[model samples]
Target: MSQKAIIEALKNPDAYDEKVFYVKVLQTHISYIFLTGRYAYKVKKPVNFGFLDFTTLEKRRFYCEEELRLNRRLCGDMYIDVLPITLSDGSVKINGSGKIVEYAVKMKELPQEALMSELLKKGRVDMNVMDEIARILSDFHKKAETNGKIESYGSIDTVRFNWDENFDQTREFIGRTIEHQDYSFIHRAVQEFLKNRKDLFRLRLRKGRIKECHGDLHSGNIFIADRIYIYDAIEFNERFRCCDVASDIAFLLMDLEFLNKSDLSNRFLIKYLEYSGEEEDFLEVLPFYKCYRAYVRGKVTSFKLNDPNITEEEKERSKEIARKYFQMSRQYAEEIF
Candidate 1:
C-alpha cells in the first residue's frame, strides 16, 4: 500500500476498531503511530539501518511481534498484540479481511502527564518515585534472562565495540554539533577506562552481572502511573539489548543528569544499588557506562538533524540538545578522573 493510503486509513478510525472518535497520528524516524484514544497502533517504516532491517513486509511483521513480546516483559498490559493491516479493492484497513499489506503493534496508551520526562520537567519527580523505580528495576533484573552467550556481550571487546560504534557514527558531526575537544577527551577517556578495567568487565560477566536488560531506559520511555511502566525494549537486535545491567540503568541515570536532576539521579542510583544488592564498588565503573549513554543520546539527536521531516527550528533545537548531551558526556568522562 502507498503512504497516501496509509494516511487515509489513519484518518478513518473505523479502520482500526469500532469507534468514531478521531485518531491521532505520531511519527518517528522509523514508525507511524496512530493513537486511538484508548489504544495506540505502531507501524514500522520500511527503512534499513545496518543495525536493524524492517525493509520488507515479512521483516516488519516479525519485528512487530518481537516488539510486542519483548515489551510485554516490562509492560504487561501496555502491549496488546501485533495486527496485520490488509489492503484490497484500492483501500487499506487494519485487521481487515483482506490481503495483509502491513503490520502494526497495538498498545494501551498511558497518560501523557504520567511520563517521567514530563514529571521531571514540572519538578514533580520525587525520591518516592525513584525508590519505586529502583525496586521495580531490582526485581526485573533478578528475573532477566542470563546465559553464557548473552554474558559475552559484557566482555571488554563487545563493550568497546559499542563505544567505537558511537564514536565512528558521531565523528562526522564533530564541529557541527559537538566540539572537537569534547569529542577527543571523551574518546580518550573511554578507551583508557576500557583498557584499564578489562578485569572489571570480565568480573561482571563472571558474576552474571550481564543479562537481557531494558536497552533503552531514558525518562521518556518510563511512565509513572500507579506502577512504573518501562516500555520499549530494543527488539530489533539482541546485541543492543543484552549487556551489563549497570549499562542498562546508566541510560536512565544519564537522562536524569541531562535534565539537571543530579540529586535525584544520585538518589535513584543509590536506591538501585541498595535494592539490587550490588556492591558500592559498582560505582567505580558507572562513569564509563554513563558517558556511553550520554553519547548515545547525542548521537540519536544528531541523527534527527538530518531528517527531512524536521523543521529548521526543530533541527536547530536538536543541534543544541545534541551539544548539551555531548557536553554531559564529557562531564561524565571527567568523573572517571
Candidate 2:
C-alpha cells in the first residue's frame, strides 16, 4: 500500500481494536507513526536517503524486524511486534490475509509525560531519575558487542570518515544556516583534535570502550516509566551506532546541555563516570565527541528544511534549531585546542 493508504487505514481506530478510543497520526522525516491509544504503529516511508534505503518492501520488512529485534534488548516490553500491511479489496488492512504491501513495527504506547524530553520541559527529571539512567547505560555499554573488527571502527580513520561525511553533507548550508568562519574554524579545530588525539582513541579501543552502543541516546528516546525504557536504536547503520562509549554518552549530555540543563547534564555525567568506572580524565576528550553529536543534530535539523511535508512555520522553527545546534557545535569546538 502507498503511505497515504496505509496511514488512512491506521487512522481508523478499528484497525487495531474495535473498542479503541481514537487514533493520532504522527510524522517524522522517514516514517509515519499511528498512535492508536493502546499501541503505536510505525510505518517507514519508501524513500532512499543514501545512508538508509527502505524503498523496497523487502527492505522495509527487514528493517522492521531489525528495529523490533534490536529495541527489544532495552525495552522488550514496549516493542511488541512487526505486522504486515496488506492491500485487499480497495482498502488496506494491518496484518490481514492479503498481499503484503508494507510493514509496521507495533509498540505499546508509552505516556508522553514520562518521556525524558517531556519531563525535562516540566522540570521533573531529578537526581534519582538521572542516577537510574546513568546506571542503566553503564550496564548496557558493559554488555554491548565488542570484537576485533567492530573495534576497528574506533580508529582515527573511521572518526575522520564520520566527520568528513558530516562536513560534506552540510556544506551547502554553510552561509545560510551556519556562518562561513564558524564552519571553517570548527572544521579545522575538529581535524586538529582528531589528528592530535589518536592516543585517546587508541586507549579507548584498547580498554574496550568501543562497542555497539545506542547511536541516538538523546532525551527523546528515553522513557521514565516503572523503569527507564530507551528505545529506537539506529538499526539502519552500524557506523552511526557503533562507537566509543564516551561518544554514546556524549550525545545525551549534549542533548541535556542543548536543553539548558547543564546542572542535570553535569550530575548525569559525573554519576555515569563513577558508575562506569571510567577515569575522570575521560572528560578531557568528551567535548570533541559532544561537538560531533551536536553537528550531526544540526545536519539532521537542516535536512528537515527540505522536507516537503512540513509547514512553513516548521521550516522557520527548524532553521532556528539548526542554527542553535551549529552554534553549540562551534562552542564545543572552541573548547578544543
- Tens digit per residue, CA lDDT, model 2, 1-337: 4576677777876566335657888887888988777888899988776768988989999999989888987898999999988877866777876788888999999887889999999999999889988999999999999998778888899899999999998998987788899899899999999888888888888888889888999999999888889999988877888899999999999999999999999999989988999984478779999999999999889988888889999999999999999999999999996
- Most TM-score-accurate candidate: 2
Stretch of 10 with least lDDT, candidate 1 = 13-22
Taking the tens digit of each residue's C-alpha lDDT, what string does model 1 give over 1-337? 6654776677786687556355888777678888777888898878775667888889999999999888999998999989988877866888787899888899988777899999999999999999999998999999999998898888888888888888888998999889999999999999888878778887788788899998999899999887889998888878889998999889999999889899999999989999999975477778888888999889888987778767899899999999999999999999885
lDDT over C-alpha atoms for residue 249 of model 1? 86
- What TM-score does each of the candidates earn? 0.96, 0.97
Candidate 2 local lDDT, residue 322:
93
Tell me the lDDT of model 2 at 36. Answer: 72
Model 2 pairs whose backbones collide: none
